[model samples]
Target: MTSAPADSVDALIEAEFDKLDLNHDGRLDWADYEILIDRYRKTAGVNEDDRRIQELRAFYQLHWLELLRHSGAAGDSLSRNEFVEATRRTTGDTNRLDAAKVGGHVIFDLVDADGDGSISRDELGRYLQGVWQIDQSDPRYDFDALDTNKDGVISRDEFVTGIQEVLHA
Candidate 1:
């Protein structure tokens, strides 16, 4: 796939970071993430199992921390500039490619809730809701593109490779 221009990619990442900031606070901190998690937990309904909620909480926590660490601001929040810089770093060089691949795997594992080595539409939807604050009414990614084989499920290969393609494109 042809890579997108670096400027475009950077702008895209920046826009995404703005979306995740949630509170219009111009930065993303632990509290902002917690607010999102809480909203999702509530949206999941009281009937949702505690175990599942806990698992999602853990995943979101790690996801938040990982993003912070990538920005080299683990103990603090990230401004848009910091986030965009970190993302740009991951799009360059062999070491960056390796890091990006590992990060992609981590995300795939998180979303594959049943641990069946693939992500179903339902799982992806739920993950988007809980982690990214993306409601069922709004998908965060192109589900069709990620499915790759039109199989209605995203295998680990698809998730990782699709992520790489997205990053470079």
Candidate 2:
């Protein structure tokens, strides 16, 4: 359970801006800015059904508007670092929202690859690969950590509750 970096938001923002400034130009045209935001929506599950980019655009329209308003009349675009900080800060505190945490359900769904309401070690390995970007070949791929009770399977409760202790606080 690695802690999110102290500067996760900053890094996210910076990376986006750097990516948008493809030509190393200080300014971003509409196409350039949209490209960056498009990536964010897809990765964030704003558009997971392969729907049109407009669907993703609608998801971010209000949030981007809010961010712009928060910026107090920005320049050509939100700076790279600012975008990440905004995302991190805007995410609701998981501890405060117990209604199945914003992403906990998504993570659970991801782990339950077969839609079987629970996960086995193999399913977990694939989930970690797809969602958390973990490599199964990594030396630290300890299957036992998630297989609480040593039953050789990861019940939803075990995977969620066990990982939270180290990851949440």
Candidate 3:
């Protein structure tokens, strides 16, 4: 597969950093992660007491720690450049953290509103539109592209693989 150009990848990473820097504070901290986790919880309609929500919290905590560990920053938060570099290392280092697998599982759980094992088109659309505010008109986010088996829904494996591809890319 052809890889994206360095400039394009850097641009994408910068864009992702902007999104994750929720409060526009120019740094990524646990608070940003909490905001993201809360959004996922709201989208899933789960309360803080719910087991799944608790798991999601745990996942984010671990993920945040991993990012910090990889960042090599002196502070608790990561600057934009630090975050971009940390993300690149964390996503590429499967030995230390299988980000795609762990993140994909949690995200899939949140997107599967019906508690089903797979992601339906409607569920994905809702997730894309709600959580990330991604425009549904974007062809790149099409369910058909992710539903490799063409089974009308995206299986856990398919979803994870798609996430892995993006992370690596």
Best prediction by lDDT: 3
Error of 1 at 160 (Å): 1.0
Superposed by TM-score, candidate 1 places the C-alpha of residue 47 at a distance from the truth, in angstroms, of 16
RMSD each, Å: 4.7, 7.3, 1.4
lDDT of 2 at 130: 48
Candidate 2 structure quality by residue, lDDT tens digits, 1-169: 5666656635544654565564465643455546654544443344545343444344445445544544543563655555544444444333333322423443565456566887777776665554345677665457687676998887878766754543342
Query: lDDT by residue for model 3 over 1-169, one digit each (tens)?
Result: 6787877777778888887887789998999888888877888888988877787788778778888889999989999889888888877777866888888887888888998799998999888877777876788687898999998999999999998877778
Ranking by TM-score: 3, 1, 2
Candidate 3: 10-residue stretch with minimal lDDT:
1-10
Evaluate model 2: give its TM-score.
Answer: 0.45
Q: Candidate 1, residues 66-161: lDDT per residue as tens digits?
A: 566578875588888888876666455444235446657756655776779999989878877666756655543867778989999999999989
Question: How much does candidate 3 score in TM-score?
Answer: 0.92
Candidate ranking under lDDT, highest first, comes to 3, 1, 2
